[model samples]
Target chain A: MNIAVVGLGIIGGSFCKAIKKYTDHRVIGINRTKSTAEKALKEGAIDEIGTHESLENADLIILSMYPQAVVDYVSRYGEYIKKGAVVTDVSGIKRAICPQMTELSEKFGFVFAGSHPMAGKETNGFDVSDADLYKNASYIIVPCNAGDSVVNMLSDFAKSIGFGTVKITTPEEHDRMIAFTSQLPHVLACSYVLSPCCPNHKGFSAGSYRDVSRVANINSTLWSELFLENKDPLISELDILIENITKIKDAIKAEDTDALKALLEKGREVKQALGE
Target chain B: MNIAVVGLGIIGGSFCKAIKKYTDHRVIGINRTKSTAEKALKEGAIDEIGTHESLENADLIILSMYPQAVVDYVSRYGEYIKKGAVVTDVSGIKRAICPQMTELSEKFGFVFAGSHPMAGKETNGFDVSDADLYKNASYIIVPCNAGDSVVNMLSDFAKSIGFGTVKITTPEEHDRMIAFTSQLPHVLACSYVLSPCCPNHKGFSAGSYRDVSRVANINSTLWSELFLENKDPLISELDILIENITKIKDAIKAEDTDALKALLEKGREVKQALGE
Candidate 1:
């Protein structure tokens, strides 16, 4: 397969390198910034670094840009992609971009599906990108009218790069699931980090404290955008998490050890079931 | 100092190894079960394995028993401990035990201060003990009676085991701090793990999920005792955590991006301030 990756940042650069390492597919990278594209190619992330014009004949096209850029770019350049070629993305929130992607695919006679690889680092960008980033990670695949052939191709492409793809029911489901799994937790971590007693009382941090706050030091601008984009579902999940914690707090307040134990036991069971 | 660790469980065994590795002290292992005591000795966790009689000659006595066991064993054996010997502990909670420890010390001709080395693993017992457990971990030192030679000796012992010790103002302060930093987080993790969606979802589990749930698969029996013992402060911290989480949840439900952003920012600032 000939793969064209737009946006040569952390996810895109890593995808390019992974394709080169794990498959016979030839990867071409297209970044809005020429320097980043050049760096990706020079770092062996891709077989070639090219301008957007080079996207014309690719077997697969991936929009690895920010959620907003992906929506804008796919809408504008959907026609440049080859007819019947598989097109997907690495956006965080699927619902926000999936509709635009579907419309773009339909208008351009191409196949568009949205994908979210559940992997990243606190520090990002091309410099920290590696081929092994998705070695054991999940990639949520949301296909809407992209056709069965295109979905299969995208799934094959994702599997070839070492991802366990979950065929999500809809973009809404994908977004909501991720809201619970990723977004809410990040929000919680960030809040815990900024709490008054933390950085100020440096001497008191333990392993749990460190682990809970590991993702606190994040790219605030990017995260802020994501939180805004996926606001609806993320909020719902946050509410559920808060409700669960509130139940625990009330039980603790009553000194109800039995209730607290039951709550903790439930969590343990859930985590064990998830095999986490 | 000649130190006697009066329990050969996970923490005690690891303590013995860490002290031996970093200090010149003579380490003694005491356990109700003779075979376990012998095992700790044979494993080099102790220079000697003996009875409560060993406490008579020791310059320092490290109480490495369970939370409830500490009060019980100390109350009965308080008569055997040596004059002017410094007594300390490695229990998870401080407030519940420190007052009793102070009272016991007064009657036994010894000084009782408390400490908690913030390092451990999910697995228990002597078999999994390692001397490097405390390296790079914070050790919270709670000294009693306005601090004295005993406090200095306890601090030295904590430092000897590769920990940076911080002096806690009082037992209540120590308990409240740990409840937030340690206990509440554990409850959250345990709850997340027990949630239905998490069970059998390992393939979708990322570093974030793993980070949060790593400590969930803990020894629940031991945790139950700790929770019950430190019920007061644990309950207080649980309320704060619940409130924080619930506040975020409400913002999410109302689709309030500003509120969500503020909460996320709070966590991020707290974590980053810790220099993680």
Candidate 2:
């Protein structure tokens, strides 16, 4: 199978590297930056640097661009993709992206399966990409009716690339789960670093402070794009968290130790209940 | 020098072990539970099991009990502590305990310099204590006129016990700094783990989820006491964080991608500005 990975950034680059390492797939690269493509080729992440013409022969195309770029890419190149070719993505949000890609695939006589690889780093680009980046991480598949062959192909691809689990759900479910599990943490970490008390962190910070704010050091521009694209579900997740936080905050404000303990106990119970 | 460590919990146990390992102080341990004290003695964390009479001859006394227990113990035992002896504690909050301790020390003619070791694990008690726990961590001292001698004494003690740094600050300042770095994070983690979406985390959680929620598996009973004892500063810190998160939440609600991106960028900047 010939797999073309678009955008040669961390996610796309990783896909190419893993496919090249684990399978006999003909990995082709399509990056906007010629330099990035050259780097991927030099690193042997891809067999060839692909042009728009390469979309016509790709058995599978993986879109690793940010969500907006993805919409734009499909709009521009959907007509050129080979009939019955499978298209997929590594975007964080899925509700907004999956349906549009699925529709475009139908009009263009191809398959579109939306994927959210629950793996990445603060660093970006092809140079830092690793075949094992997705190791022990979850890979979510949003059903876009790309057929069993395509779903199985992508599942195998994900597992071969080190995804610990690949589960299927609706695009909305993907966004919802990610909002609480992934997006919400990023938002919380970013906000946590901006806390007024952070200026005094020099001699004070320890494990919890470091742990809570570690993700605050993020790719701002990329995250900004991701946050805005998944607005609704992300908003709901934030509101739920804010409400929970406010409850505990109120207990502290009122010096209600009993209430505070109860709130924390509830929180403990919730975290404990996870994975059980 | 004779050193008495009250409470054979993790912190005090570690202190005793380190002092025994690195200094010539004759370490004595005071504990509410005789078994814990016996365990400390058997583990060689302390040279002797201490009684109320031990304070009469000790050159220094270190309280490692919880905040309320420290207050109660000091009030009960202040008269027994030898005049001119310096005392310190390893309590998490200071404003409530430090002032009371300072006043008690003044009344008793003993010096009280509040101390907080910025180190601990999620687990507690003497059985898990290690001499190296403070080797790379900060120690804050709230000086209460033990004079230069007492400050030097405590500073040397902290360093001798493998603390990375020891700095002096007012009790108010210590509480304020900790509100942001320590207390606020506990509150947020406890609260964050309580989000309505947490029940769905079985196969969805990843790195960020684990990072931010790590402290959600907490010592809630102890933390509730800490949170309420330093309620004012903690509440103020919580408010600041809520306001910041709300700004981002509002941007999401408005579907204002630019504003959301800008908020995230600001958060990224704050995190980046740390240590640079």
In model 2, state the lDDT of residue A179. Answer: 85
Collision count for each candidate, in order: 28, 0
Docking category of candidate 1:
medium
Evaluated with DockQ, which candidate comes out highest? Answer: 2
- Cα lDDT over the full model 1: 0.76
- On TM-score, the candidate that comes out on top is 2
User: Estimated TM-score per prediction?
Assistant: 0.90, 0.91
Q: Which tens-of-lDDT digit does each residue in B35-137 have in candidate 1?
A: 9888878878899987888889788887888777888888998898998787888888877788888888888778887878787875578788889887877
Shares of reference contacts reproduced by the candidates, in order, are 0.52, 0.76
Stretches of model 1 off by over 4 angstroms after superposition: A146-149, A164-172, A224-233, A274-276, B33-35, B146-148, B164-169, B228-232
lDDT of 2 by residue, B7-85 (tens): 8888999999999998889998999899999988998889999898789888899999889889899899889999988
Q: What TM-score would you give candidate 2 relative to the actual structure? A: 0.91
**Residue-wise C-alpha lDDT for candidate 2, range A1-276, written one tens digit per residue:** 889999998889888888888888899899998999998999899999998789998988899998888989989988889998888888888887877887898889988899888887766778788988888788888868777877887888888878899888888778788888888888888888887778668787677788788787778677877787788888887888889889998888888888888988887787777732
